[model samples]
Target: MTLKPARGLAVLLCVLSPLAFAQADAVRKPDPNTRVPQGVIHHAATGFPDRIVASPLQAGDAGFAVSWRTSPAVDAPMLEIVVAGDSPDMGTPRQVSSRTQALQTENGDARYHHAVIDGLQADTLYAWRVQGDRTWSAWYHTRTAPAAGAPLTLLYFGDTQNQNTSLTTRVIREAMRHAPDARLALYAGDLVSGGDGEDDNEWAEWFEANDPLTTSMVVAPAPGNHEYFEEFEDTPMERRVLGAHWPLQFALPANGVDEAKETTYWFDYQDVRVAVIDGTSALDLGTAEAQARWLDGVLSGNPRRWSIVLTHQPFHSPRAGRDNVLMREHLLPVIKRHGVDLVLQGHDHTYARRGADAAPTPVFVVSVVGAKQYRLSEQARATMRPVGEDTQLFQVLRFDGGRMRYEARTATGRLYDAFELIDEADGKRLVEVTEGRIDERRCDREATLKGRKDRCWE
Candidate 1:
């Protein structure tokens, strides 16, 4: 049997004639900027008000693959891509093209609709919206990555799992304010607070917090353990939503195999190659075979100037239940072999920076942006090297043609950590950062619940 490209992989182009174009100029055009107009429209196989999101628009790739949600979802939903080119003046933007097709929707409690807009020109700006039946979303726009060898800037955030709207929002907005020209946003996962098992309100909060940032920020998120449902054994309903939320929210790369296809994949931005992995899948469920194999292949295939690995579990972490020995055993070896420059993770609910344990110091960092806080123990503080607490943080990473620089800061703009990774012929050189003094105060004083710590950081 022959394997087929995933439903959203098709590219449709039309060869237009000169005389036909002249005659078509007589037809009337509709306004594309109109709001979806609040009205009940028949749910297209792929149309609903999902937590609409876009991932990094790689160099030479088409428009972003937008994923959204709808109930009673089918395997396929028709998606429409309307492209609007950039403009120099502040007047109306120019329309480039538009097309529609049937794409697949991964279904469950939160059904997912995904489609890739192909044939986009590199380094050009474009606007698009996904629709089903009569329902259409506000057009969103993203600029494709500049061609290879171009300088780039990307933002990285750890965990946004607690009190998302109130806490994480301030930190995220501040990060964007510091560096407004970032190309892509890399989230280490736990993008939501579904760990408590209450789905409806929790997801809404996550969306509310991220919506403002995502307007222009192309996000790529890995799954943290908090993304998992609390009840594992009983409800099939819960199992259905296990990994469904991710696909419905963000349109990621589909080149990986099996579970890694959309959940764990690699893509190129400018001169850098980024690999996103699922620590939850590999560590919790023991499906490391495909990710490991895919990771190796991705490294072997990469010729980019810089390579980075992203996940939710850190090999060097200060939080409890964070050390995923399985990931270290299977995945870290590949990263080391590939000479990856950076590894970003979150699960500790704090920020930390560590020196390279393996040969080349692959600068490893962990951070959090939620209301949920934890204390770093003596062992954790000692082992993790640089530690932070009772603070919400975000990272701004810049990759120029020559050097890579990163800064960790709090929502109030207090500098926590800062460093530069100098690129060399053999490998990258790490520069130690000295910023704010490590806050050693413990937050868990009075017991809150039976199982976990009580006072966060008073």
Candidate 2:
């Protein structure tokens, strides 16, 4: 197979350069000592062939759900949850209960499967695993939400499309290095390249890229523009492939808008209410009325101290001059009234941060982890306090007591930017990080010239 570099990682064809490819292929084989294969793709054994994933881990609470896939579409994958206490002799977790249900793929593949493991104890570490007929995955452990009022921590990532398997892994692994047990992970969308309309391999590369972290971590994903596939009623290939794979891989809260478009939903953690909206549906298709209504309900009804909104498009764009002004026109007021703390997004393929102000000035961020590059927009430079044109980065947000600190770091652990969002109910204070010299250009309209100029004051 001939392969080309997308984001930044050099793609190696399985057949190209026979000697090198052969050596690389030799490493992907399942090892007796390793938990997962290095290179070969592994079909989730416990759930559908697509996903053997754990998600919706109740934040600041002690409960979570484990969803997986099974071949031949079994009734349910066996779930074993064991709470680890002080005693080292807890041995292995015994079988608790199971759910038998059919997972229907949006594209009409009935072979899909799903199950939720609920009602586990709180603030405790639990060892669990999924089991199918001929395949039983190795046991893994997860820490539930600390407590209802306890401070929470999460990792935020924007776009990881394009050269996913190569550059994406570095950023993800770096985030874990900063905080391995981050309670939650947020995505601004465009998790994969080759838009939902075509480029099936990008999806595979995406799954392959994040397999290291997602297999054990809980991630909340919102759809980005690239996730949308242009298709008429007659042939919706993108929806079929991406849709079938998304639900199969990640188990999200089934609770969402009655009339909202697909995969748009909301779920609450201890003191936080997180809502994910399908921006593409709302912006391009004009079919997100139900979603808008649902957002209203979630925000109006939510009683959490913090409400964070996730979408693929950014409200305060550093690029495209906030091209999604239509989206802002509709949802901005709702967010303003509801007191949303953070607005996470992707699509710009760069890193940006704005001051947190009381006038519904939510901290809008656009960071990309993939290898794709884009010129920094003039508006982004003029508006955002800090914007990077050529950096691959991820962010870590830690909520410890009354103070919330957000740190953005490069794949190599250099601090790119930082901010503090205090929950005074009044607003968060702005703290600029000047650890590194940011003497880089603000905007390079000719995508090729981005980051090649110097404009920052020394």
Candidate number with greatest TM-score? 2
Candidate 1 at 398: error in angstroms? 0.5
Model 1 TM-score, 2 decimals? 0.76
Expressed as tens digits, the lDDT of each residue in 206-263 for candidate 1 is: 7667775664656778877766754555766334225445555676777765765557
Cα-based lDDT for every prediction:
0.67, 0.66
- Give a tens-digit lDDT track for model 2, residues 1-458: 53446522443343357566445544553212112244443333333244455677434364666655555545555676677656756677767455544433212223333445566666667777776665566666777766657878888998887667667878888898898768778888888754333333455457667765665666788877666555553564433223445655566777776544356877776566889987777777664566666788888867677778998888777665457866778887777777678888888777777654544347777787776655567777787867887778889988776577788888788887877766665665555557663444343232221222222100
**Candidate 2, lDDT over the whole model:** 0.66
Candidate 1 lDDT:
0.67
Show pairs that collide, candidate 1. Answer: 443-456, 448-454
Instruction: Give the least accurate 10-residue stretch of model 1, judged by summed lDDT.
Output: 28-37
Candidate 2 ranges with C-alpha deviation above 4 Å: 1-51, 57-62, 73-75, 85-111, 195-201, 233-242, 356-360, 425-427, 436-458
